[model samples]
Target: MTVQSKQGAYHTGTYRNLLLEFGYSEEEIQRRVLDNWTQIFEGGEDTRIYYESEDGLGYLEDTGNHDARTEGMSYGMMMAVQMDRQDVFDRIWGWSKKYMYMTEGENAGYFAWSCQLNGTRNANGPAPDGEEYYALALFFASHRWGDRTEEPYNYSEQARKLLHDCVHKGENNDGPPMWEPTNKLIKFVPALDFTDPSYHLPHFYELFAEWANPEDRAFWKEAAAASRAYLPTTCHPETGLAPEYSFYDGSPNHFHGFGHFFSDSYRVAANLGLEAHWYGLSDDLVQIADNIQKFFEDKDPEDYRRYTIAGEPFEEQCLHPVGLIATNAMASLAVPDSPRARAAVELFWNTPVRTGDRRYYDNCLYMFSILALSGNYRIWMPKN
Candidate 1:
């Protein structure tokens, strides 16, 4: 039997606490959320992924590479907001603005995607994925904790201005826009023509339409619609695996050897799940999530491998099995009652957060799955 839709008739700021519904006691839910958060953000010695520098800047390092990425920094900030850790959120935001924000160039208003521990820019370019996450996290921060008078601390204004630049960057002929102007789909980067399937977060765009500058609200609304329509085309009909990068028409664009279902493609399931939970905009998403879970249902997590969209495995082993499992469990938010969904969640519950050098990405996805499954990853509304 297919999973039943939980799409309520209207949007509520809150969602069903799935953990409770799944037979987890309140104490169990609270402990799991806090324990996971502590392990990720403040665990003793062997477990924590976040750290503070001598200069008081807090950053999340991709320990495997010995570098900081906007992806991790912004993701850390988002996690901080969702968990109500304002101090941690402020610390991460301060580090991002101090080190990652670009000031006078074609990419001004955008952040440098990578940096060093000493706050040095590793590259002068921006990544659209990080910028979008940064904007959404800032918006949530403004609603949850209110804004401040300082530069980067003016959360709502910072988010609004960033969204403005995302769609209007090339109007003065300085740099290309982060999104393609005509179709309103986000680019892999401002200079590219293809899209990252995981980068199309229509739920975030729906909120942007409501919170961004009035002049750009229409564009964001159109973007939400465009992305909702775009995702189904990009995913495989039978397997539901998406490429890391694809053209606007949903064909894989293999420019950088990212045409397969690899590291970046894992988030597509999670994104689609959240979109369904938040806005109830697409029923097709449930089928997509089902197809993905069913394809891997019987495979051992340790043997998970990289594959083409049609489900052909390659010699390359899966880089982050914990992360893949986490996202697969997260897809349960969209397809709650499927046997595969239950199996995925059980697997996640049994797996601990990854430790050691390559833990950053896996742990981040792990924490996100924890939040989403507990129904704590919410839309914080502004206090009037």
Candidate 2:
């Protein structure tokens, strides 16, 4: 990721596969992920908006230059590979190593939030949220690349830090990752906000558990299991949708917004568009959709999901039908030949842009969920 600069324009790239490769056939996902691998590189690259985008990249504008931490960048980069954009993957990976932290600084192995629009940490310290993403990305990177040395991170050491030093476990064993003890866990800047880190953590650790020490494996397993348990553990048997919320003591805290559309959209997006499927590891996107649909199906218009902290439910309903992800996921997995599959993809493709959004919380999430959904790089579509 890059910082906003007024004098000159620059861009940075990452290759994390946000959804593991949804919608496209596996071969298609591989093709795009491989094709766009060069944007991660400093100079050597092919042609793609990733390498050269007119809209601007980095912090200059909305070309996804924010959240350049290892987890964020790595996750995006990995997903780029999943999208079959190897050019983007290679470019992002090639350049990211220069900015990566390997020294034994207090925050070593973790990463800073932003770097130069052109290069690495010519900037400052990473956001405390780094641990959360680093852990998440590490899981996928190791699985995808199998070379920790290549990424400037030792999976063993990094996982150790995430479990013992970086994570802040709670009653559910799932909470915001710990930042510097120097902050004594009270710093306000990184205190859990309404940020999006929910589904990733589970996917991360589940992959780690596959290659970890027996003890480490167990730890990652527990963490993954806890995350699954903490989420919408139940899905609709029919439509497969459910509520989205951050809970404290199994109750809601709506500071961000209860079952907010963005998070809800993500669940829809992830399930309908998830790239990978591992039993007991990554949560099932299809099942999640069905349950979410169930969660809201029979409820009345006045029905609402809210933070119980205030002892009240705010009346709200999702105004957008990002369910195209869900429909696409089903299509790619089960009904590849069906007309509805193409229609579902078309609905998602035209949605919000050509179709117009029915609801939105912030344009950031609107962009985030859509882009993350597209990270798979479905080549069957015209652009791919």
Candidate 3:
């Protein structure tokens, strides 16, 4: 397999289980990870988000919205592949391909961002975040379980085709590309002009550069570098809080008043944490993680609120306080050597996966944090 020059987990094949590092037994860590999965995927109806149809397909419901979304489906696929649950991965993929994949439209190659439980389209548009995760998760599935000869089960081909469409969509005057070609930056949606800071996943793009179609490899490589360079500019100098949406120039986009730190912004820390764990965390990333952890060190999750990048709080309380906690703890991966990192981990360990109305998003982040901090989340390489 080809390897990057950087000393990342993909090259070294080594991962740190922070819970074990901090004196948790290996058995406990493994059990905790499994328990969280069971709770999310198979527990009581109150806790479980995954539902399987009699036809052998499955979908993750956004409990709050009461619909299936590409974001949750792709995330469930990624989580399944990471945990070696091929059954779950295939079911989710099948459901997604059957229900969400749009054909003969402006978004012909893309999946509808949202769909009803009965597989009805909620909107005809696509979300770039979902497309990115879908491509990456499919790649992981191909490497982990091998591709099939059938349509949706041809995992590697599915991934490559998705990536190809993401970059080349506008060439034929069909739909706009998910990323801005000139800057190599991902837009919030295929048709939008602004970007979500949390969508900048450089680590995933690095792998795409190596595994994507040869003609698109250079573009993926440039996209990876561009995201890495763009991230630091999105965060505040002191607070390190990033806006949910920003412009290509890294300034917060005031469009729809999304320039504040809120629900989507929480993923920025979690993304940086995973990227730092996979690739080497740079000093700037370390500082960014440090700033975020320090900023919330004394704050209670119950009081979490919408805030400006400068750390000013709004009257609005956070919709996903549990998610904020999980992501903040995940940020510890970037600052593993700091006492603050240990503190964050301790806090996360004490928390439980959320349930009820808004549990889907929060619990997904919680499960990811569990996998990542325990080093269970890994890069699946080609077997041959």
Candidate 4:
């Protein structure tokens, strides 16, 4: 295994082992990962606005929604932490929190899904998950920087309090569980997709444990655990596709034909995009990943061709499901010494779709990949 240098927390042996399990040389797996990184992040950037390149911005041009831009920021921050690219990480980190945070909005101080190009105010409309993303990022960034009481991470404290209010604070008034509440309860009564499982959210509990009341740890863990477990049990068998909406009771919530194409269609590619490890797989998550992989890798080309969303009729031919594939692949990279792990160090060369905020997403993708691949893929490319 490659020994941890002063620069990296990642080791080399892990990647070697992971590749061997996949029945390939460590170099081959490393090669594949490196290739994917370079290709996907081809025109990617590491600027204050990640999607933008030297010539112009990608998603920042008012794509009508800030979902991609906001999420992209989170991805960039995450990548920065993983790569240990302190300089790249810090600048983008500051840029995002300053512009994208939705601390004061028409909606109960929700995070804006889109930001204006001028960098002054949000474009409009809040996404169901936007605030959650901000909170998640702040909490993780605080943890990554190893600073409990710092200026930058100060965002985390407020972010968490908001989540508690929105997701958990029915105590203040009558409302639904943290999942979804009437907007009037606060502002914008957006219906939520309650079901669809996969609760193993990154750093949720750690944050709860770190910042929330101690008594609340198990509660948060249980809630998340139950949600994640629901997927393997309640999802469709043939497609392993989860329904768009799940119930508070873990029952199938959405109406028939309500499943999102992203579940099955985007899943394959999304798996590749995952920035988490694939190992130490919880029985449920492993099953979810396995089920998703089976559908994609095993499906015939005929089955893969032109598909429609549950409600929409748009159709297009599948072109290897690259976008979603990278997402999923990112997950596999997270777990070191796994049958699926990728090397974390490869991020330097792998590149990410999130270029301008390069440190954010790129670092994240590398973090998981290097961690998992190093622990397992040691046999073929031993160094440590």
Best by lDDT: 3
Tens digits of per-residue lDDT for model 4, 165-187: 55554454433334433221111
145-262 per-residue lDDT for model 3 (tens digits): 8999999999999999999999999998998999999899999998888899999999999999989999999999999989888888999989999999999888999898899999
Q: Return the top candidate by TM-score.
A: 3
In model 1, where do residues sit more than 4 Å from their true spots? 1-10
Q: Over all chains combined, what TM-score does candidate 1 have?
A: 0.96
TM-scores, all candidates, are 0.96, 0.50, 0.97, 0.60
List model 2 lDDT by residue over 1-384, tens digit each: 121222111011233332343345555544533433332222222221234322232221113343244434554454453444444544555445455543444444445556654554644444533454445444444445443464334543454555554443332433334422222221212335322223334544555565444555666666655545543332223434333444322233345454433333344335333323222123354344444333443433234333122223345433433432333333232222344434444444443321222212122222333444444322121111
Q: CA lDDT, every prediction? A: 0.88, 0.38, 0.91, 0.42
For model 2, the stretches where C-alpha displacement exceeds 4 angstroms are 1-61, 64-72, 83-87, 90-109, 114-165, 168-197, 233-245, 256-259, 263-276, 280-287, 291-346, 349-384
Task: Report the lDDT of model 2 for residue 264.
Answer: 39
Candidates sorted on TM-score, descending: 3, 1, 4, 2
In order of listing, the candidates' clash counts read 0, 64, 0, 86
- Please identify which of the two predictions, 1 or 4, would achieve the higher TM-score against the true structure: 1
Candidate 1's error at 308, in angstroms? 0.4
lDDT of 2: 0.38
Residue 298 alpha-carbon offset, candidate 4, angstroms: 4.0
Residue 263 C-alpha lDDT in model 1? 92
